[model samples]
Target: MNSKLIKELPDLVRNNVISQEVATTIEAYYQSQQANSPNRLFTVFGVLGSLLVGLGIILILAHNWDNFSRTVKTGFAFLPLIIGQLVVAFSILKHKSKTWKEASGTFLFFTIGSSIALVSQIYNIPGDLSAYVLTWVLLSAPLIYLLKSNVLAILHLIFITFYAYEIGYGHYYSNETPWLYLVLLGIAIPHYIQLLKHRTNDNITSLFNWLYPLSVTIVLGTFVKDLSELGFLMYVLLFSVFYNLGKMPFFDTQKLRKNGYLIFGSLGIVVLMLIMSFDSFWYIEELVFFAQESYISILLFFVNGVILGLAYYKKWLQSFNVFQYVFILLSLLYLGGLNLPVLGTVIINILILALGITTIKIGADKVHFGILNYGLFIITALVVCRFFDTNMSFVIRGLLFVGVGLSFFLTNYIMLKKQSSKAKTL
Candidate 1:
């Protein structure tokens, strides 16, 4: 419903372009459409306002903290929580709009944590920061589904990631593994699934697309207790999983920018390959296989194999990029490197070079500027790696750089000329 069109309806009627009755109907129809549209700004501001107000209340209470009696402090601690709960209850019982549910739910979420912290402080309760965060996360997890709030769901993910870091990395001497992080992540999956099924194109759904993989990427390192060398293998497998998941029908249709899994997976493999190409990386003193401490990495390897098997069964391999299947080659190279380090180094360097050329070919076939530039970047990066790692003369290294630069210019120019020719013919 264009406002300009609505305004011109009367003029159209007066000019005999339409009857008065028709003009009135058109105006009414547009007015109804405008009314039915969701107010995105209002929802955003409402959530922000609720968040700021909650923080403000805490700040205000903190300012006059020492002046208040113990009983007064106790009352103040629960006041915000009680108010937040009531608001959330009203929003739920009345079946309020999305804005109301989100605003109230966000306000209540912070209040629960603030109240918990205040009570612990006032009563001299004993607990570590990790325990406090776990409590806050658990209490607020239900709010995500109860109010159907995307904000709460995102917050839950952040808190869980924080909790994982606190337990796994923050406590150096503690033997606690962040295994609970996986369980907490699993609890949030149904909500994400619902979003995938019903709100596939939503902005929140896109946010989840980025966060889910990033969270796992960050947390996967926590599982490495010993045999740290195997960590690299674990990461490669994880990225492979992400890449294949992104190739599924639902994710494949999305724009490249929105497909975080594909982006992360491809970039991860390329970076790992580049690192492993160095001759120094293959010089291992001791090689351990199937160690008890390396179970997480082993399990991940099997999981990646299963995923690859499924991808093959589904015939996805035909459309996959070279990097998608490069993990297998790298795995074998790692095993062979245990005995023949120099050979492994040579093969990896050759593999990277071949990968760059293949990528360039794919880019030429697709006529995509981004893909073409990415392929060029891979070659450029490989050249840069050799510049430092090899004992080549300075003049030769400079010539290599110049050659890569020339290729970039010529490749892009040819691509643009081809595109122009097609445009003109069309």
Candidate 2:
């Protein structure tokens, strides 16, 4: 509610601009609206306070650990868990506010982990860090939905990502697959869906948007056992899926900064294209597509294809992003590169140039300065790559840099003028 507007209501009524009844009604309505809005700060503080208190208890207990007997240590291990459970139970039964539920749920989540760790330490239980984390994550997964806690949901994602890295890429367990991470991720999807449906503009939803793709991107490498060269192609397909997903009406309607899928997908494709533009990337001694060890990559490629096909069926092409079609081009290029590496390199350079020009056009049409500069950066990056790879003279390279610099200045100047004119008209 606007405090100034509220203060003016009486003045307006005194001046006969509004009736007394009207001012009263307006004040009451705003008061009701203010009361109904969620108190985000309170929720944040409550959750933070719970975390600090939980840590404080752990520290105090740790200080006197050597002095305590086994019985007392065992009781202390269970104490935080019991207290947390009581808090959660109360929050559920009493139908407490979101702050209460979130704070209690967060406290309970840490307590669960603490209790496990304490009991393990107290009884000399044997387990690796990965197993301990996995157990903690599995136990806390229920709290995300049970308490309707977004914080817990985000924490769950982080923990699962860590677990994937530990199981998939850890020194002791490099050969093992982190397949359980996928199932755990699937469990958290419902809550994310609910957030999108009911709280579309929420900060938590934005966090999920960023973290979800990032988590996938980080864990994707863990699935690559052999045919490491094919990993590049796998990432291309994955990013295409991300780009297409971002093009959907749900994400497309949101602000660009909030749509991590679009940003990651676009940037991923561009970076890969730039890397492959080099002749060295296309040169291969052995190209194996159908090896038994490459099954995961093949499966992911097929799945990504299906997803892209579905996106196309749903009219994703109407948006006409160049990166959306790069996956197809790159797929073809990958096969062709095996025989004619130079041809593949040339095609990639052409594709990147085309992508940059298309981006520049789109930015101009929309009068978006950021998009315009991004396109310029793309061209600039390509030129830089060429400078290193080619035998071009320093003078030629410097001229190219100068030309790119001029383009950047001119494009930005034109955009600013357009914005100024548009603003004046408004």
Candidate 3:
């Protein structure tokens, strides 16, 4: 990763026909995108069709009541329900249609299923909303695989998205959101797998970008019935999204950006504010504070760590902004004594000093590590650790800072020479 070689990474990534994992992701993206153009067209028609049919049914119900008894009305209400289930079953069975036609029929069958469920409820049919929603999502699930329809997959995603939104945010914050997340994954995952196999579908990526957050948002919101947990979780999430973005090789900026990192990452920021507000957690309030086993947060931490390692493995220093900084905070809270009072403070000071040295050395290797964000991040962490943990003397802190600064300078001097020798080999 010399200066000249570092500059060529992105172009080489895009144009070199190596077609490795990079090609799978890239190919998946473009394939999904091509599928997306027609997907949009079919989607509009499907929604319009659902609405029109619903409207027409409503008009018939209003006027036809005079011509029908309760039994007749009930029979009619169940018509779409019965017909929809059969059509979906038929679509699954019909293995010879054009992909678009198979997808279109499945889409309509789902819409009709929803229409029946809605009508059934209005007519006082006995079923829970979750049950109905799950049924619809489940029934549509097979069509996604059966038809190889990205649109079918996305609709299933939206169905789960709205269901989760209802459970997590609506007046009823039921336990349904989790189940819905699983269901969405049920659909989005195959599309994800297809993107892996075919390596040319853009719609799959679009749907992935669209559904992941929708599901994650609902799930994260569930983590906090209170503001405190939600707040801490936010910063953790920011690390996840940023780390995810930063893990992309210098060449995958477009693909990474297309994945909606910022939108999800912004929410992570909002959550960070929430997490930071709980200054009490950083201190010793053993009895008053109840620590939950934040599986999600912990999972996020490990994920961020992997991202940092990938960036390092790829020599991606200039693009190092995501979850890497998360390590500083994580290092601070290392149940391994990094977060202990006197111990934690001293450890952070030392870690930052080491980080500054590492970044400068790495930067020397690349020559265009830009203004070294990783090094700047280390400095910022040192400042922030000191700001929040005021148990130390200012003089001691100042001396440590000055010491690390000198180390940074000398490290770079040695690193530059090492990198120069390395580059001579190239």
Candidate 4:
């Protein structure tokens, strides 16, 4: 059957027009199952069940390790861990080992590592969170390399993430935490090297898949914390990531499927916008731009100009989105530099109207995707500004609101017409 028929066949079966066996057969024939790896549902359940039992043992030991002697407990303390390490070594040695052996060995090392540390805490080991995370991460790294197991790599990466997220975000600054950054980079290097050489292991790729952006964002966020002025700079940095990724020659579908550079970058942009909604990242406040702190204001303006210039250079200049920040900078200059402090409210309304009208014109005449966003920008800006600017004249403001309301339907119609015309040209 054709694609349409195949799609409809599922619904037909679901509606009880076909038998379940027949449906299953059709699905299997249409979707070929890869034969390299056999199904391992039982193996997975066994591992999970064993892990739970192991965890129960650790909790019991953690609570009652005090009654045992130093030598007896020391041997006992390392017994599970030593055994786990040996199992990992054995699994690695057997190149043709089954997946269960490989997975179980990695799982045992992980369990033993954590359990040993918890037991160590019973002996009153006095290490900080960073030190603790570092120790565990180092111990686990070899399992990743020796076994070439993503589970081991992923486990190490998870603990490394915890180290960075918990301690890095909450404390410390400067080059002192270079060790922590190094550990994170260490976790990434093996996978990055592999992903470049071979994009076959989707699971390993998926781990870095998440870990890279997460690690990058965490690092960057740590760098720019507590700096409102630098928040705009952070957006520029984030967008630069998107601009690069969207241009990269690599066609690995896994990269797009698992990673979210755009989502993270967009979040950074939104935060910058919200901060600018009050203090204005690119310029001084609305009414007071003329008498700005000249040095700081100029530096910030130049920074914003650089961001827009990069965006334009990359040809990623989505109209209203790029201009949202640009307008914040401009609106500051337009209202404050013009010596019209009392007319601030009027200027904001006028600004919204201008954006809406420009959108309609752009779609109608210019044939641009960026233009599609302009009316939404104006409408949202009007709504937001009105909510905060409580001192404005009611009558004049009421008229502006009504005027923008009418513009909405008109702009939609114009953009639709423009889009239809553009489609014809295509």
Alpha-carbon TM-score of each model against the true structure = 0.89, 0.90, 0.56, 0.60
Q: Rank the candidates by TM-score, best first.
A: 2, 1, 4, 3
Model 2: lDDT of residue 101: 95
- Model 3 TM-score, 2 decimals: 0.56
lDDT of 1 by residue, 208-270 (tens): 999999999998877766666777778888887788788776887787777888778878877
lDDT of 2 by residue, 1-426 (tens): 769999999889989999999999999999998898768899999999999999999999999999999999999999999999999999999999999999999999999999999999999999998899999999999898899889999999999999999887886547777889899999999999999999898778988999999999999888776667777788888888788778777897798888988888889989988998998888865767676335655675677678678777876566566776777778777866785778989999999998899889878988888878899999999999999989988999999999999999999998999989999999
Model 2 spans > 4 angstroms off: 1-31, 291-293, 423-426
Cα error of candidate 3 at position 96, Å = 7.8
Q: With candidate 4 superimposed using the best TM-score fit, by how many Å does residue 269's alpha carbon deviate from the native?
A: 1.6
How many steric clashes between backbone atoms does each model show? Answer: 0, 0, 18, 0
**For candidate 2, which ten residues in a row score worst on lDDT?**
291-300
What C-alpha lDDT values do all the predictions have?
A: 0.86, 0.88, 0.55, 0.55
lDDT (10s digit) by residue, model 4, range 253-351: 334444444334433433344433342233533333232233334454565566556657866654554333533444354435433444543544554
Task: Please give, for residues 1-426, the per-residue lDDT of candidate 3 as tens digits.
Answer: 124543454676778744457645665666676654444555567645655765676677768666787677667766656665565567566643344344455545555565656467557778765567767777667766656666566677677766666666665545333545664676568666666456533544655654666566555564444444333544565445553663465313435345555445533543342333233344432321243324555566677667766767888766444234644454345444412446544544554455455555545655634324455445555555555556677887787677667756765566667768779999
Kindly report which residue pairs in candidate 4 clash with one another: none
Give per-model CA RMSD. 4.5, 3.3, 10.1, 8.6
Ranking according to lDDT, highest score first: 2, 1, 4, 3
